[model samples]
Target: MGPGPKVKCPPRLAPCGLRLVQVRFPTGLTSEEYVKQEAWRFARLERCPFHPEGGCGLARHGTYARVSPPGCLIARWWCPTARTSISLLPDFMCSRLTGTLAEVEAVVAAADAAPTREVASEVLRPDVELPGALRWLRRRTRLVHAGLAAAIGLLPGLLARCEPTITSVRSALGAEVALVRLRAELVPHLAALPPPLGFGPRPAQRRSSLTALQQESGTDPPSGTR
Candidate 1:
């Protein structure tokens, strides 16, 4: 069948225009429970976040659903002056990625604990083919490494002394819930970093998978792949 036609991704909703505000949820809060109780209504902005001087006409913009946590609604606010919208995202929900932060952490933790990316893929995602699984795992690992790097730069007093590695981070902070702890610590500065950790915009998508895979392994790209 030669090569299949490329699939088109749906247009992102206001890529640069949307900002995120992290909100904490009570323990054991499920997506279903969140929707049923109309939890989105609870997230409120007293004044215009963009224009705190007073009079920017910030209004409640309704809610948006998340794909991972089915039925969960994120509350939104619109600013007329800035022409941007802010979404109140619950901390449990991963910012840019689909699944929750806990799920993302599990994937990365498993990969880090394993001997190699190849080994980790086989153990953590046996259902997926090796190449596909590596790509999936690589994405999470790269994003997390980026987030950790940002964390270190932002909190130099606490983290600057430590080496820039996940193991070092886990050792410096809590082992099991390092990502969760980092998220809470980065709450004030979330706007500067990108998601799964913060609300900052994601970097541009790479065009070449082979290059990404090569970069992930820190090896020269194999001949004949490109």
Candidate 2:
């Protein structure tokens, strides 16, 4: 069988947007219990007659909750990618700190709401053009060209020896392998060499250290943090 094709990493992050919410539950509850509570709350909301019943309506759904030490439950709700509405629970709770369910319902009724933002077309843009295939072709073409040039430079010797085909093949193969190895070694060494005199931090190392800092902080690291 012929050699399998090589795989390359894609150049961009996936188009999907991830939303994370951090919900704190009372201490001593297990992850399962917190998730159950969230699920129940969501279900209650979904069944409530007050809930809007149409495009982008709210509904309770099961979701994985990350449980941290000392009984912290972070429940995340993902707004649909196309929907951008922010829940007013924060404001509602703050405003109606001491009120009956009916009174709170009045507050919910009184709050004037705004429409959610539309998803940006640019955000869902198509994948980038594939340059990997073109790059590989160029490298191979250069190698072939270099080998041909070297062989032509040696043509006189081969003609003198009356062994044109064999000598040409050997010369080209040797030159190609030598060029490949030289590139393999030289490029990495160049990369490993500290940034040019004034160049800033190495991207990979900087990213790793930043990630370490974020993990230590115990908060969701910045987006694209990883």
Candidate 3:
């Protein structure tokens, strides 16, 4: 019962103590298929996540479903000695945030293609008021842009001197789903950064309800903050 991609952190480093990591698949699998088959049961960890030596009582800890992406269950394990648990999130889904990776990318892509944020909000979220829609669009846009910047710095050779934009990432990686592809490249450092890249701040077992605005804007940092 951590934040479902609805939680936003400040611009500065905010480490949520959650031990969630993504599990990518070799073959192509849609989010729907992943949920329908309960693919998380197939997730494996060769070594103890918390205690990599050999054995530390790391065992399957059951599954938890997310609010978004109906019926999706997160596979998890726990280290009894360490008194901690790790959730193996399927790559098809966005960490911290709700929905699939493609859905997040699509939102950013649509805004990137729009002439202006105002226009993008209108088209992307006509159901909501203009101000709320803009907030929703800006949150995703900022997150994607920030993640891309971090990607450039992380993958110097692959993305050296490249602009931090969706177009640049797509061209550099040669993939349409740039964020998902980028996630694989930055697997080792995923825990250090924010979701889609890393997990953001995790409060001490706190779960707050999302307001109407929060529901519209999945993960918007406070105004005037990152």
Candidate 4:
């Protein structure tokens, strides 16, 4: 849905470049109509992250429309050297997830609070199926746990107490905004780092799971936007 040579990039925006300049969007605006009016306002960009020639070539290439969930427009910045446009995405949504960050957080909380998917569903996601919600939660936990561990230091076997993830997850449970705060601190920074880390078997006994997932998904790593 952004720029680059990949077939998935949208057809609009002149179809060029791989690099983009990202700008943060504030919350409150919702729906396609709202997005259309606001997307253009974030069009301002600067030096390209992918260009080797050292030029602030990011320009107001155009806007792409999105429907579903929040339904908002995604504005793109064109980078000639990268040969594509970069869509400015909101912090509230993951680049790949179909649901909003709140939705994702809801599911994660549900999963953590309940013993079974059915139980969690009954408590929160009564409208959705278990398989879908559980899978999404697993993926997010995988990324967040591993990514955070990678971004910061964690203790090794026997001394692995106080890992950043444990604090973050506990924080999430206590506060509604905790998950969002964690995502803000982690996702964007981790996105640039491909090949997620495998933290190892157990923070207290062996290699953490973060290290394990990295090894498993190493062949094809996340683009970070996910």
Off by over 4 Å in 2: 1-16, 21-54, 69-76, 81-212, 215-226
Q: Cα RMSDs of all predictions?
A: 11.9, 29.4, 9.3, 9.8
Error of 1 at 53 (Å): 1.9
Q: Tens-digit lDDT track for model 1 on 107-134?
A: 8878888899999999878998898788
- The C-alpha TM-scores of every prediction are 0.72, 0.21, 0.74, 0.55
| Alpha-carbon shift of residue 38 in model 1 (angstroms) | 4.4
Whose lDDT is higher: candidate 2's or candidate 4's?
Answer: 4
**Candidate numbers, best lDDT first, in rank order:** 1, 3, 4, 2
lDDT of 1: 0.67
Best by TM-score: 3
Worst 10-residue stretch by lDDT in candidate 2? 88-97
User: Can you write out model 2's per-residue Cα lDDT over 104-195, one digit (the tens) per residue?
Assistant: 22222222121211111112212423343223222222223333343334444432332222233335446422222222222323222211
Model 1, position 136, has a per-residue lDDT of 78
Q: Estimate candidate 3's RMSD in Å.
A: 9.3
- lDDT for each candidate structure: 0.67, 0.27, 0.66, 0.46
> What is the C-alpha lDDT profile of model 4 across 1-226, one tens digit per residue?
2333322223443434343334444343443434566644555545444543344344566665543344455666666544655655565544444445555555555565578756765566456566544444555555455544554442233223335453455443455534344444554553442112221221232345444333333211123321
- Number of the candidate with higher TM-score, 1 or 2: 1
**Model 3, global lDDT:** 0.66
Q: Measured by TM-score, how close is model 2 to the native structure?
A: 0.21
